[model samples]
Target chain A: MRNVAIIWKKEIDSYFVSPVAYLLLTMFGLIFGFFFWNAVSYFVIIGIESQMRGGGGPMSVNEYVIRPLLSNVSVVGLFFIPMITMRLFAEEKRTGTIELLATSPIRDIEVILGKWLAALTLYGCMLLFTALNFSFLFRYGNPDWKPLAVGYLGLLLQAGGLLAVGTLISTMTRNQIIAGAATFGVCLLLWVLEWVSGYETATWAVVLSYCSVITHFESFAKGVIDSKDLVFYVSLIFLGLFLTSRSMESLRWRA
Target chain B: MITVEGLTKRYARHVAVNNISFSVEKGQIVGFLGPNGAGKTTTMRILTCFLPPTAGKATVAGFDVLEQPMEVKRRIGYLPETPPVYPEMEVAEYLRFVGKLKGLSGANLGHRVDEVSNRCAVADVKHKLIGKLSKGYRQRVGLAQAIIHNPDVLILDEPTAGLDPKQINETRDLIKSLAGDHTIILSTHILPEVEQTCEQVIIISQGRVVATDSVQNLQSGTRGAETIRVEVSGRDGSIEAGAVRQKLEQVAGVSRVVLRESSPQLAVLEVESLKGKVVRGDIARAVVQAGWNLNELHTAAHTLEEIFLQLTGAQPTLEAPASGEKQ
Candidate 1:
């Protein structure tokens, strides 16, 4: 555990020192802020907020403002997750530092956990910046605090799962460009599977959607907390880390 | 102390390291000598617990590399062929990270980081980012990381592989200074480096242990040891060289007798005796007693290059078993 913390601390500092982290976080914040503003304007400009007084629509200002914030975060996630995860192990292998770490007394699993925690820490910071929308909920409009808190919970789990999965892909290659491609590909597959299973007529696809990042996030994103959904994301985080450890074990011999 | 027995590492159809066995006792600096691709790095990796052998066992400080890898890792410091470095971190930060991973903390970790930095001569660049440092400094930082924990066994694979001559000499001296307290196993194909830096040499060839001995023993065995050469001639063929050798064998301290290469009539022989046994006077008397004329005697000199070539490349010269013809 200390080794993991040591690795995490160094990695976090390294990320901040590099320009890449700052650039990605800045871009993610802008995109998220835009999504929330769009949701506010959509309800007001379409006269939907006013017309839904009798209809079963988002009549409250809180639903109009907060649901928009959570509604499109899942989509915005498609662009944001890969940036935080691209450098987990691929860069280490390319620079030859992987040998230094692998030969250390620390176990392979510990290294994986350390790297995942590092990336997730950055992702967690990125999610924290979205708090602006939450504050706006209580300020300029009515807000359903329950769904908003649940939305943030779903966002954290979705980000954790994607980070773990993306890190596993990063371990499979040395080129950052290739790691980015593979990470983006896997995240896209999981996200798209959610749509195919839940939105389309495929029953088995829907079953697999349980593994999709969205399936677990949907109920929680709407202010509903479910243990099974949390389990699915936690299992993913563990499974991704497990595969990463195995990849490193094989790589030790190859190197 | 470290022992590797029948260490074999195969990659699919090709064997990177074949069955090889050797040991390094406590406080001894052993040099692993071999040409490129001779499994010098592979063997070091196995001992460092970085890679498990395909079929063999290795122990470091009494811990099995396969069964107790972490224990083996804790006891050994390894420098790979290429220095593993994180470019963005400063030298001090990098060393601190390695020290912490080695289970060092607080004042002890701080002291170790400082100690290794000063030892590797990386103190000046402690605050500079490793990526911005020179290649030599990077190598030193790598050495710093390896020794930060003050491990019992230090495994350096090609420590001077790509250094300038001046840097090589400095690194050599640094490694030499480490011999008394650290059990070091360093590998390099540079012949003279092993001759100068190590007391014992283990030469690996084609993934096998070709020779293991003290530097002096290996030198003497592969290339004939330095010995006095004697030339002799008979005035009237009064006595044969064989007669002279029989008499010489009876002398107080003569050990070996052989015919000379200059001429068949002239006998050149090397006389080895127990330490402190002087046979020069006895040899002269024996030659005179056998009636053989002695012309010249001088100790033969052979360089280490010849010895290394013979030890590393001594394949069986195929010839007709009964034929006496020279190929």
Candidate 2:
């Protein structure tokens, strides 16, 4: 456990010491800020229309403004998660520092968990930027904070799953660009897997949609803490980390 | 402190380390000498637990590298051919992180970090980022990181590969100072490095151990047959190369003579005497009796370079009977 913390600290230091962490934070803030503005303005325009119609129905800010904003945040994560996890293992391998880690007294699991947690932490920081935008709703409106918290929980779990996958892919190659591109490719595929459910009700199609991460995240977005959704995201994290451990084991032999 | 028996690593296409076996006693500095692609790095990698041997076994500090790798890793400090450093990290911060990884903490980690920094002469650059430092400094930082934990065994691969002459001397002194406290095995293709630093030399060639002995033993062991070079000039200001070669060959105990250089004023002949023969006096007398001034008479001892080449079979020496007969 101590070794894991040591690796975690080193990895975090690497991210911040370089321009990568600041660059990622700035890009994510700009893109998500635009999405938040678009969502808020559209919600305001709709609220005005309903007011012009004599307050047709007390519009719920939770449903109208925050839900779509959180969902768009997940989409933005499809791009940012790769950037966060791309260099976790790839850079070490490229710079020959993997030799030090591999030959150290620390176990392989400690190294992998340490690096994965650092990526998750960086992603968590990126998510914090979204909270600043969400704080505006709480200041002015009577939106329920419970569902907002659940939505944030859902975003973290989903990013955890995707970042775990990115961590596994990062171990597969030494080039950070290849790792980033491949992680994006895999994340996009997972995202689009649910499209088949719209056209086909075949059992395979159902299973494919069931495997889609978006399917599991829907309940969290609606403030419903379903056990199955939690199980899905947690299971995805476990599988990704387990495979990463196996990949790391194989490296000792192949290297 | 280290034992490897028939440790072989077979890649998909070729064998990196063939069936090789050697051992190092505690507190002994062994030099792994080989040319490029000679499996020196491969062997060190296996010992460091960075790679497991495909066959056979290795043990370090009584821990099997295959069965109890954690124990083995705990006792070994490795400096790979390329220093495994994170370029963006400050030197002190990187050493602390490595110390933490090596199972040190609290005040002990800090003290060791400071000690190793001073020991490796990297204290001046402790605050500098490793990437911004020069190559020699980076190499020293690498050395410092390896010794930060002060493991029982230190495995250094090409420790002075890219340094200037002064840095190389300092690094050599540091490595020598590290002996008797830590058993170290450093690999290099430089022969004189082995002669100057290592107590034992393991000459490897083509994935095999060609010779393993002390530096002095390997050199003196090849001194069985003596060789002397005699440069002579005629009293009349010119010497005949053929006449000098013929006269030197006739000297007692002189087995063969080859004319090395000839000019209008001098003739240099290399005289190879029979095994364990004292022919220097005979060759000098023969030159003087033939009315030629003996300009130079010196016995050429077999150097480590010749022994290494002879053992590795990289090149046949000029005096080898087989090559001589072929010529």
Candidate 3:
């Protein structure tokens, strides 16, 4: 237990001590900021029609800002969450420090949990930075708090699911570059399922896509906390963490 | 104390260490001598619980390595050839982390960190990042980390391998100081290191125990060959070489006589004997009385280097590695 906390503290220290974490944070902030501004400005002046035909469009700023945020956050999240998790075990293995940790008195599960918790903590901080976008809505427009809160919950759950998938991919290799690419590939593949048409196939795909992280998060974005959605994210986290622990054990023996 | 029995480690095709076993009593500083790929590291790893033996048993401080590895790990301090250190951490912080991992906490952790730093002479570089330190200082830091918890056994693999002459001398002195309190298994290909610090030597080659005994015992083990190296000065004159050979052969246990060299003037005799007593004293007395100049008479026993070469089949003399590449 004490060793787990020691490892956790060291991992969190590694996150902030390097430039990579800050760079990713700044990039995420900029993307969120740009989309928030564009969403609000598009409908704030007069509606969308004036620029095209001098006839006003029906969508209001709330429709513009809130609609894009619900979807765009999911898209933005797909990229951001993986970047945060790419180095978890992969970089440690690459550096040979993983061997030190494994051979220590600490158990394999402790190492997996400590690192996973650190990655999740960093992702949560990244998600918090996205809240600044909603701040703009609160100040300039009268945004409905319930829907926005629900959206935030969904984003939180989605982040949890994406973080798990990212960690699983990182467990596969010692190369941080390969881990990053693999995590992105998995996230991209799942996120793209939403584009496929036909309600029957897309519905099942959407349901699976609800397992897809971004899809389940979409439900909360419109103001609902589905227990099924919560359970799916929790189960994915458990599965990912369990596989990570097993990988650590296998690698330890092999070494 | 450590006890090992039938320790055999095999890879898929070849055995790295085969049925090799030795025991170290408390306070014994045993040096492991072997050539490269002689299974020195593999055997050490097995004893340290870093690798499991294919079929055998090992116990450190009475805790079976297989059944209680954590207990073994707790009692052993290992420094691999590369010294597992974080390049980013300062020497002090790294030691502190290691101490903490080894179960030292609070003021005890601080005290141990200080103690090890001073013992290893790494106090000056305690605040310097390990990557920025020189090879010698890095080695000291590595040693510091290993001994921070004051383990009962210190397994240092070539601890002085890449050090300069000054650092090598200092590290050797440090190890010598550490001897009685900690049972140490210091491995190296360097023979004199065994002579300097270790009371007993265990030489492993090609995964087999080629030799294991005190330094003096190893030298004297090849005493069966009854050849006494004798140097005599004789010109064209009075003394018969055959007469000296015949008289020396008459000694009890003196077996056969083979005179060495084409130079008749420089008569060197190699006496083969079943040999009761060494008989060199008697032979020397007789040779002098016979009117032959007895220049020198020395009992020929194997030197440590010769024994090492003969037993392990390794080169007796290897060129010292050029300075910069030693690192």
Candidate 4:
């Protein structure tokens, strides 16, 4: 655990020293801020329309604003997660510094976890920026905070899972661009797998839909924390990191 | 100390390191001399636990590299062929990261980092980003990282490969200074470098151990079959260069004679005697008998370069293989 922290700290330092971290932050902030403005303005316009009609009670901000905003942020994250995890192992291999890591006394698990945790922390920072924007809703209206907390937890778990997979992909190649492209492709496939459910009712389609990351995030976005969803995210995270450690072991053999 | 027993590393259809074995005693600097693709780096990688041997065992500091890789890694510091440095990191920060990874912490880490930085002559650029440093400085920083924790063994793969002559000399001096405290295995194709720094050399060829010996012994052993060069001035016009060469080639004990250089006033011939024959006296007597002024006649001791070329090329021709040669 201590060795993991050392690697984690160095990785984080590497991220900030390079322009990639700032580039991802600015890009995520802009995309999420745009989504937030659109979601809030749409919520306010609908609130005004319903109030003028005088038919329904005041609209629930939880449903109208916070929920959709969280889901939209999740979608935006698919694009940024690749950027966060692209350089984790690929850059090390490209620069020949992978030799140092592999030959160090630290365990392969520590290296993988430390790098994955660094990516998750950077992703967490991007989430924090979006959360600051969501804090505006609390000043004027009483939106339930518990759902937002649960929603953020879901975002983190979902990011953790995808980032772990990205870490595995990063270890497969020394080219960061290739790692990024492959991660984006895999994330997109997972995101769109749920669409198969609309056209087919077969067991395969059900399994595909169940495998889609969106299927797991949906319950969390709606203020529900199903143990099934938690298990899915945790299992995916473990599988990804497990594959990364295996890849690291093979790298030593093949080097 | 390090030990290897029939350490072999095969990749698919080709073997990178054959069943080669050798050992290094504590506080000794052994040079791994080989051509570019002769598997020196591969062997070093295996010893450092960066790679595993395909079908053999290697132990470092009494720990098997395969079974106790972490233990071996803890005792050895490896600098690969290219300096493995993160370009985005400052020198001090990069050293700190490597030091921490080696399990040093707190004040000890700081003190060790400072010690290696100063020792490596990289302290002036400690705060400078590594990407902006020159290749010499980067190589020095790489050396600094390797010694930050003061491991028992240091595996340096061509540590002076890309440095200027001045930096190369300085680096050699620093390595020499660390001789008694650290066991170093430096690999290089440059013969003079091994002569300058390494006490013993392990000459590798085609993934096999071809020769190993102390520098002095290797040199003196090759002396038995040394080449002799003779320059003669044939009284300005008493004989043509061809006649001078013909006369010299007739000398007994001379196996092969080649005309090295020829002028109207002078001609130089290099004579190679058969193994175990000293042809110097025979050549001088023959030159004097031929009525040619023997301007110069001296036996040229076989340099490591000739021995290296002969060993690493298609032929393994050393009469007495060094003590480390397995076969």
TM-score of 4: 0.88
Model 1 agreement with the true structure over A160-184: per-residue lDDT tens digits? 8889888998998888888888888
lDDT at B73, model 3:
85
Which candidate wins on DockQ? Answer: 2
Query: Which CAPRI tier for candidate 3?
Result: acceptable
- Candidate 1 CAPRI level: medium
Model 4: docking quality category: medium
Model 1 Cα RMSD, 1 decimal: 7.2
Q: Give per-residue CA lDDT, model 2, range B1-327, as digits (tens).
A: 999999999999999999999999999999998877889999999999889999989999999999999999999999998899988989999999999999999999999999999999999989999999998899999999999989999999989887788888999999999999999999988777889999999999889999999887787567567788888998999778898888877888988898889998998888888987898988888888889999899977678788988888896322321111110
Model 2: docking quality category: high
Chain B TM for prediction 2: 0.80
Candidate 1: Cα lDDT at A187:
86
Against the true structure, what is each candidate's TM-score? 0.85, 0.89, 0.82, 0.88
Worst 10 residues of 4 chain B by lDDT: B318-327
lDDT of each: 0.80, 0.89, 0.77, 0.89
Ranking by lDDT: 2, 4, 1, 3
For candidate 3, write residues A111-164 as lDDT tens digits. 777777787777677767777667766886676787777776777767777787
Candidate 2 regions exceeding 4 Å error are B226-299, B315-327
Error of 4 at A130 (Å): 1.5
| Model 3, runs deviating above 4 Å | A43-67, A136-157, A193-211, B12-14, B222-305, B313-327
Per-model TM-score of chain A alone? 0.90, 0.98, 0.85, 0.99
Candidate 4, residues B125-204, lDDT tens digits: the string is 99999999998999999998888889999999888887778989999999899888999999887888988999999999
